[model samples]
Target: MGGRHVLRARRLMEGALDGPDGLDEEELVRAARAVVAELGSPGRLSALVAELAAGVGDPSGCARLSYRHVLGFDKLLLVSVGTRHMLRAHVWHPGSHRAGREDIHNHRSALASFVVRGTLGMELYETAGDGPLAAARYRESLSAEVSDWLLEPAGRARLRLTQTAEYTAGSGYALPSYALHRAWCASPGAAVTLFLETGAGRRRYTDVFTGDGRDGRAQAYAKEPLEVAEYLAELRALAELIGGSEELARS
Candidate 1:
């Protein structure tokens, strides 16, 4: 526990020579030891940390972040810096939503997302092997019968989780590149989570993997590049099937 003074986020100009930028490939992964020092009591962090946690708890309620010139997007709030992967600050618009889409910028890196406040309903999809044309593919294995899934598995798993698959507030989830899933808000409002990557610079593959593999959530044991492509493609396809966007796919 530290002082009661609120946490003031230190600003780093994007692309500027700062504590976060200018690292090459190797340094990106095994860089200097990074840590987030708890500045406040165990009960409370600075205003910025607390605010970020609250936003992730309820993303639908989190309106897109807007600051005169800047668009208040949930994505913007999930900012990353240095090697610690600490959230310096966040800006959000309550009761907001976005659709299932890809970052498309870099797809080669391993990514993870964690939820803090809100709830989320996520699903994975894939594309048909017939070659990118056939209405996209979704991961599905006959679970004996759909009813069997509920009776045999649900009765046990349901208690621990919402039947809707919504991860509640105060909880966070880490999603891989190939896990194409969307967040859904319950009857309440916006929810939140953090998206993180293992590598650096502009990610190689798209951030969100359009599922096109066998395992959406869990890939095979092998670490082949095809495996990465497979799982990732499947993830994206699933998200695309419905409206991966915030409002449409929002649970």
Candidate 2:
């Protein structure tokens, strides 16, 4: 069942990419939501992820899928690179322990996210300025770029509440490029999400910021893309930890 869901997602993404011109944010969101609805919950999605990872095996293998951990959660890259779009599975643990209640940030490319498991509370914000959200930027030795932001003591940048939503298993939402918002997991539980990014790019970059200058938290952070082999290992480890092996075989 779980493997079927992964296949279903792959088919949906392929179809969208193969469409006459291409899928926009709305179309992509609808497609991803369909997959989430089919998978039913985050646990189901995790099983599929584990199954895929276990199949990939070690570094000498030839699995095209890759992975990375960003902002705390383990993310599995579902498709190959140089494609028109990208699909990622975000696996979050008990709390926002890696980055507590994330500071305000936004993406350059449009994305549609589905909550496969647990719950996530999203807070959307808006500012008077027409530029992107406030953030610090840095370059990494691995040739990847990183960005960070503070949320407390908002300082001169006043953020206006624009929208708020809580997404549980089977629920999904879409965000346009430059949409300013942050998310936190509901207490006492883990969360899993699937994100479909259209027109993705490394050069596009991200920004993070805090509310005021008094907050001592570091405003800069590093980010690097995960290699395919390492990503497979992470998935296999997660599969073992989550007891998805039995289901993975059947998948």
Candidate 3:
């Protein structure tokens, strides 16, 4: 992937964010998917991923992130963080295990994920019964505070599991800001997922929930900041991991 392909990918990303405002949540997702689909196409997917991997060669352009809120990841790599969007890749190394199921949470921005390696178990949930009370369990925070994600005790509201599926290499998924979802990897090997978050349509705050959607308990987690040098090393490792995947086979 050269600079030309990288420029093309950036254009697609910007197109996803340049849509009209005031559209509904589903419409937002659709708009994002329509643009993201072009980047994921068989003709250009490899170049896009290669360009993202090549980006790591520039020490000034990459960062390593310790997820303060999301856990159970051996590594999380930040490819880029822009004003209206961000790109990240999550890697779960072999033998890593999460203590418990991940929280079912909603994002403030729309998201699209591409499975670069291994498999991911994805589940989406819809709020049933009292939507307002259900949405109140979350607190708003603009800073880096993991404690802010604690679920407040709101009365019980039903959470209907809407969709459950496994996305493997070459597969992608789009999610609206209003969709509540969680993910896990059942395989014994490593799993890698790349995400593109379009922040243009984001809200000020998003909601969070425990596994059962009723538990209000949450423990604050720590964050580790990574320097650009260390992030470059990690990016090199990730690029190799991705290059080895069958998903990178050219059409």
Candidate 4:
């Protein structure tokens, strides 16, 4: 028998993907928002963490997939149902030491995120006619063998900022796979968000835009997975943080 948390996560994903013909963009967004709301709740989140920390589920596999993303955040895979759906926790650190301005990029699959703590700021963009904000564009794909990120120069493009928004705890948002956007922690302290990616037919590549002009060479970033111990420690810390936050809210 599976752990309660694992079973609960599977049920949530099943409900989200229950549409007869699968989920459209709007439906996917709605499902993602609803699912995250439940998963990110303090009680449920704490229970999930506790269960995983106790090795009651597939924590080892989840740990192997967890890593610190190049975009300056700790990405912990909570549950993965093949390529159809995935649930993750993103912990974003504050301050300049974290990383420089993030590159504007899109994902291979439609995604949604719910802020569990602190705030998240996001900006949406679109390609524009030739202007001052010209940026170097790259087509990012994963290497077949190691899953390393391979960024190949794809020429220059100008982008126009379409929208800017901030989401605080208890709020969430979703976007299609092709949406061009960037996000960062907007609070004074570390921020945590529960993220969900849905859709089996993922795109092979994603677009990444960087401001600095480079030598037009393909760049590769290796993905380092976490060990079981580190994963458990992180989950413990996450549980404590959520418990503390809940107490504060109640008080």
TM-score quality measure for candidate 3: 0.72
Q: CA lDDT of each candidate?
A: 0.31, 0.58, 0.60, 0.83
lDDT of 3 by residue, 173-236 (tens): 8897878887877556677776777766678666665534444543343455556556545555
Tell me how many clashing residue pairs each candidate has: 65, 16, 0, 0
Per-residue lDDT tens digits for candidate 2, residues 153-213, read 2234545668888997668887776677888776456676777666633234554445434
Query: Which regions of candidate 3 are displaced past 4 Å?
Result: 1-5, 20-24, 34-61, 64-69, 74-81, 97-100, 130-136, 144-156, 211-219, 244-251
Candidate 2 residue-wise lDDT at 62: 24
In candidate 1, what residue range of length 10 has the lowest lDDT sum?
150-159
RMSD (Cα, Å) for all candidates, in order, is 17.5, 5.9, 5.1, 3.1
- Model 4 ranges off by over 4 Å: 130-132, 244-251
How does candidate 4 score on lDDT? Answer: 0.83
Q: How many clashing residue pairs, candidate 3?
A: 0
TM-score, one value per model = 0.36, 0.68, 0.72, 0.92
Scored by lDDT, model 3 comes in at 0.60
Tens-digit lDDT string for candidate 1 (216-249): 3422121112232333332233223222433223
- Let me know the TM-score candidate 1 reaches against the reference structure: 0.36
Q: Could you tell which candidate, 3 or 4, scores higher by TM-score?
A: 4
